[model samples]
Target: MNRAVAHPQQDGQDRPGPTTRLSVNIGEATAQVLQKHKARGISITETVRRACAVYDLIESEAAKGSKIQIVDRDGTTRELLLIP
Candidate 1:
């Protein structure tokens, strides 16, 4: 089993924890968004981490009986689905 081991501290500074490598296929548009986030000073790993966090939050809310919807400025609302 692959394990995530913490990185050794250096220069007396606390750095980001070590993480296991994960391979995912994010399509072209998502890839562009990831790159954009990276360009804005966010690491690729961090970008992915934030995206995963958002998904986790959405799932948690949905499981709690919350209706997930995407609303547009024109007042159009569409229900979002999370498939396990």
Candidate 2:
């Protein structure tokens, strides 16, 4: 039998505890992305933190519309949506 141990907490670490009981329904696609990251040895908390940080950097909606961009599977850039 194999047992997994929790990683030890080191001194001077500033990691936050998981949010208090916030439940969200993640769709299948999102679950796959999270699973992929986990398989690559990245913690879900870190992935969520990185996502929130990038999302925070996006520009706010002014009188002009916000631009939405996406890269296609074939490496082409496409403007998918615009919202004012």
Candidate 3:
């Protein structure tokens, strides 16, 4: 589920720069979501990174006493407060 690996050379690595490692755990359901993003022509890395960035934004807002507002398909609203 998680492993440390170096960046691929084919991914525009002209020179061997600093080797940074990133580990991620993608469960079955999360993998399905990643596949859906791939279906839309998005790379797995990009999709995960974007999701992480969004989560970071939400966490930042929550730390400032903000609630995550969710609007359902039936026009019902829900608020989520994440505590760390």
**Which predicted model would earn the best lDDT?**
1
Which sections of candidate 2 miss by over 4 Å?
1-21, 60-84
What ordering of candidates by lDDT runs from best to worst?
Answer: 1, 3, 2
Using all chains and alpha carbons, the TM-scores for the candidates as numbered come to: 0.59, 0.50, 0.64
Candidate 3 per-residue lDDT, tens place, 1-84, comes to 332233333453325686455787868998999999999987877676566656777787778776678779998999977756
- Of 1 and 2, the candidate ranking higher by TM-score: 1
lDDT of 2 by residue, 42-75 (tens): 7766666566544543333222455546668998
Candidate 1 to truth, TM: 0.59
After TM-score superposition, what is the CA distance of residue 49 in candidate 3 from its true location, in Å?
1.2
Candidate 1 per-residue C-alpha lDDT over 20-67 given as tens digits, one digit per residue, 9 for 90 to 100: 777888799999998898899877777666666577677878888887
Residue 18 local lDDT, model 3: 67
- What is candidate 1's local distance difference test score? 0.70
Candidate 3 deviant stretches above 4 angstroms: 1-19
Model 3: how far residue 60 lies from native, Å: 0.3
Candidate with more favorable, higher lDDT: 2 or 3: 3
Local error of candidate 3 at 22, Å? Answer: 2.0
Name the best candidate (by TM-score).
3
lDDT of each: 0.70, 0.58, 0.69
